[model samples]
Target: MRFSLWQPGRLLSKKNVKGWVRLTLGDMGGFRNMKSKWAGKTWGTLGDSITAANGYQPLVQDALGFSRVHNYGVGGCPMTAGGERDYGATTHVGRSIENTLDCVTIFAGVNDFRLDKPLGAIGTLDPCTFYGAYASLIEDILVKNPLCRLNLWTPLHRDKDGYDIHYVNAAGYRLCDYAEAVAALGRIYALPVLDLYAQSGLNKLTLSNFTTDGLHPNEAGHRRIADMAISFLRGL
Candidate 1:
C-alpha cells in the first residue's frame, strides 16, 4: 500500500489498523505479499537505517507489496557492538525488531565498526557474544510465532571511497568477518542468512550511487539493496 508521512491521522484509520512497524534507518512497507495481524503495530526504530532519499516504506511496498510501513533507523547505530556502556543494552534486538514480526531481517554493525571514531573502531566480535543475542532474537520470534522465519544479512565491504579519512579504516576487520559471524549464528539456529554483502559488491558502487555524505546510499543504493533483497527472497 502507498503511504506518506503527511497523513499521521490515517495511522489510526480502520483501513490502516495493522499497527505501524518502525525501522532504525529506513521507512517500512516492503511485505506486499506478506500480511500481519500486527500491521501498524507501534514501533520504535532505533538505528540509522532510514534517510530522506530511501525510506523503508516505499522499499517495503515495492519489495513485499505491503500497503503501510513505519521506520526508525537511527543514522549511527552499532550492530554488533552496543553503544555507550549504559546504552549498549539498547540495541535493535532489544528495542523493536524483536516484537515487530514473525520474520525479521537485521542489517547493522557498519556503524559500530566505523573506523573514524576511536570508540567506533572495528573490533573482533566474539561469536559467543553475538551468537547468544542472535539466537535469542530468533527464539523470541519463534516463541511468539513458531513458524516464523528470520533473515540475517551481513555488512558489505566498505566502498572504495570508504577508505578516506572520513570513512572507517579498511584495515581494521573485514566486512566478511562480520558476515561470517552472522552466518555462523544463522547455522546455529537454522535460520536463513542472506549474505548480500558477498553476493553484491556494494562497496564497489560509484559515488553517484551513494549519498552526498559518502556513507549511506542514495536512491540508487537503496534500489540496489532492494533488488538484492528481492533476489535473495526469490531464491528461497
Candidate 2:
C-alpha cells in the first residue's frame, strides 16, 4: 500500500512524485559514489540508542578488521543540532572531529523523525533542521578530514503498536521522509548510502526475531545489521 501524506499540503506533488520514482539516486548526475575498500580503515560511528547499545559496531569492525573504532552514539539522540547534552549528531560528531577517522558511518534520523524535529529545506546547511544538520555534519567531516570516507545509513523499520514504517509523526512526516532525506543528502554529497530502512528487511513479521521491542534490534538483529553493513562497507 502506498501512502501520500506529505505535510503543509503536497510536499511532493504528483508530478514530483512521479519524477522521484523515475529517478535512480545512485545513477543521478554528479554523484561520485563513495565506494572504497574499508578493511583496516579507522572507523567512527555516530547515532542514537541502538548504536549506543553497542550491538552491531563490534561485529562490523571484527569482520572488516578496522584498525580502530570510535563509538560516538548516545541514546535518545537526534540528528538535528541543539544545546549541550542534547545528544545531537552535530554535538556527538565533534568527539572524533579531530581524529580524522579514515571512515565514518552515520546511522541516524529515527530520533529526529520520532521526535518530529523540523526537517529543514533540502540543500540548506543549517544545524537547526534535520537535513541541514546532516548536510552541515557531512560538510564538516569532509572539510576537516579531507581523506575521510563517509556513509549514511537510513533509520530501520519501526513497528511499535502505534508506529510503523508508515506512521506519520506530529510533524506531518513519515519515517520514509527521513529515510529519503538521507538518500537525498547522499546524492547531493556524492557519498554512498546504506539504505537500511528499505534494505534492513525488518518488518512486522520479522520484528520479534530481529528486534527486542519493535524499535531496537536484538543480538540477531544486530548480526543482521552487521551482515548488511559488512557487505555495504566492503563494496563501497
Give, for candidate 2, the lowest lDDT window spanning 10 residues.
27-36
Q: How close is every model to the real structure, measured as TM-score? A: 0.60, 0.80
TM-score between model 1 and native: 0.60
Best by TM-score: 2
Off by over 4 Å in 1: 1-47, 50-57, 85-100, 115-128, 159-172, 205-208
Q: How well is each residue in 1-236 modelled by candidate 1, as lDDT tens digits?
A: 45533365554444564555434323443343445443443222233443223454365445554334335455544543343532332133444443544345566545444532122212322322344434454555566656544567766555434442234344354545555766776776777777856775555445445444555676766676667766665454
| Cα RMSD for predicted model 2 | 16.5
Each prediction's whole-model lDDT (CA):
0.49, 0.80
- After superposing candidate 2, which stretches have Cα over 4 Å from the reference? 1-37, 83-87, 90-92
